[model samples]
Target: MIIKPRTRGFICTTAHPQGCAAQVRQQIDYVRKQPAIQGPRNALVIGASAGYGLAARIAAAFGASANTIGVYRPGERSGGRTASAGWYNSAAFETAAQEAGLKSFSLTGDAFTDETKARAVELIRKELGQVDLVIYSVATARRTNPRTGETSTSVLKPIGQSYTNKTVNFHDGEVSMVTLEPASEEEIQGTVDVMGGDDWQMWIDALREGGVLAPNATTISYSYIGPELTQAIYRQGSIGRAKDHLEATAKQLHEQLASGGGRAYVTVGKALVTQSSSAIPVVPLYISALYKVMKEKGIHEGCIEQMYRLFADRLYSPNANEVPVDEEGRIRIDDWEMREDVQREVAEIWGRIETSNIYELTDLEGYRREFFQLFGFETDDIDYEADVDPSVEVPNVSA
Candidate 1:
């Protein structure tokens, strides 16, 4: 059975195994070409199959040469349907890591559950003993409570009032105004439950109890703070409230990790095209404009580059005992994305942009390409027309 790219709404329903492997290889090659990082020796990356999570895993294995355990939920082959992009990505990642003589493993299951957590800890104990770094980069719409069997689905609506903004259908380059209603109190809380740092703290507690975290271990979760253009629907919206809780949990967890001289922080990352980010309203448009400006300025950084920088500069600074942080005790890698000149130009384009000139005025074409790349389509060198097996094994994981 051959596989190709298919789409439904913001999600690509099909993925190419070879294409995904190529993408992972590109990222690994980039990391290998750079100087090695004096960072974590052992790492665990939750949600480690796509976007920032996947990049974190690659950075840890290739950049830091860290033994890594990546925990993610990936779709397996069903009949003729293709496996998810992450499945192939993890497969490629595990194979590459092993070839590089880096110790790494891949676990597939819901990271929000007690059983999955236990399984991960068991792997960490048996495979790597303990991990010095944990990267929490989960981006999902829903989660189920393992203890209560309660299911919570998160919404990306505004908090207090309705939000109306410019949005784009990246597929057709259609730009239009989109209005999102405010979220209910319950919905807001549910978003917090899923996206907040509760699970992060739980992971820490479980690792601590299982003695799977090394002394002076450091953990970081990714967040974002876009400009005022997206403030109402992002930084100041329902997701923002969830991020606030996540950020606040970092402080609490930091104190808890103090016993082992460890630290916890939330690092705000730049907006980029991803399976998760493409679903967020208004962000695609904002990112399209921002990408155009940043690319012209020659400062565009994708997930791989951002994770490389985070590991090389801030997370593993010469002063290992103290990582550089903001006044609020968070790391800011969105510095370039949030530059005054970039934001100023993005805002200008955001105000007067339209569908007729979207291609010329903004990087909508680039955004579209990245969107396709997320699902293993539009790759430069892959023979998308070739016949390929839908069932590609993640070398480190039994499938």
Candidate 2:
């Protein structure tokens, strides 16, 4: 059957397998061109199907020749309908990894649950022995606690006050002023529970207890801190409180790993248009402006570029002097993207932006293109009319 993008609001119901394969190929090629890094040889990546998680898996596999275990929630794909992008992405990645003569396995389930963790540990112990690095890059709106059987949802709102700002709908490139109501105390707490460090801590503790983490192991989680334009909706918002918990969890993880010369660090990555980011209010406008400025300055990076730099430059670089870190031992690559100069310039252009001048003032067009491309929607190389197989199988998709 011919595959094309089928969308329902923030998510696409279908994905193009060939296009997803092409995307994985492109990322692998990019990683191969860079200088080699002596990174991990065995890795575990949670949320390892899309966004930063997928990029991290690609970088580790291609750049460092690491064997990886990817854990993600699987989506339905049957009949002539295409699967979710993450499902196709995992299939494409595993195919590529096998062709490269590297070991890779993908598991689809709730990563926050004990049963999934046990299955992962058994696989790792049987196949890879121990993992030298673990990357946690999950970004979800809701989580059902495995222990308590309770479901929690996260919100994207500011902490102290209501925030009003100009936002854009990227779908139609319409600019409008919007006001976001303050998050209730329950909302705040729920957001923290869902997006916070508890799940991360659970993963680390399980890996540690299972004796699957190798000595001198390194663990990293993805975080974000955008410019003031998005502070109300992003940083300093309910999500920000969750990030604070995540960052603090890193400290505890660091202590746990210290005995083995291991370390845990949070890498605050730059904002990019992912499936998760597109749903947030007011972020499309900020991302549009940021992309225009960053591109003009020749500093724009996609997920692959960001993850590559995170590993080669920050994590695996032999020279400690070259590694960038915050005063708290966390990496702040997003801060570099949200520099004062860049924000000032973006604000100037943002103030002048209207529906008439949005394309000229910001990269709204580029942002929209990227958003669609995430689901293998608008790629020039893909022939949407061609008969494609929807029954593609990941090499090792454990139940």
Q: RMSD, each candidate, Å?
A: 1.2, 1.4
- Model 1 per-residue lDDT tens digits across residues 1-399: 556667776889988888888999999999999999888899999999999999988998898889898989967787768888899899899999989898888888889998888888899999889989999989999999776788998889997899898898888988888999999999999999899998999899889889898878999998899899899999888899999999999999899888878999999999999999999999998999999999999999899999999988888866565778889899999999988999999988888899999999999999988888887888889887788778877877722
Best by TM-score: 1
Clashes of each: 0, 0
* Model 2 ranges off by over 4 Å: 321-323
What TM-score does candidate 2 reach? 0.97
lDDT of each: 0.89, 0.88
Candidate with maximal lDDT: 1
Worst 10 residues of 2 by lDDT: 75-84
Cα lDDT of model 2 by residue, 1-399, tens digit: 877666776677778878877887888899999988799999999999999999999999999999999999986486657777888889989998989999999989988789999999999999999999999988899988888998889998888899988888787888888888899999998898889899999998898899898978999997887777788788799999999899999989989899999999999999899999988888888888899999998889999999998988789877774457888778977865878888899889878999999999999999998888888878778888888877778888896
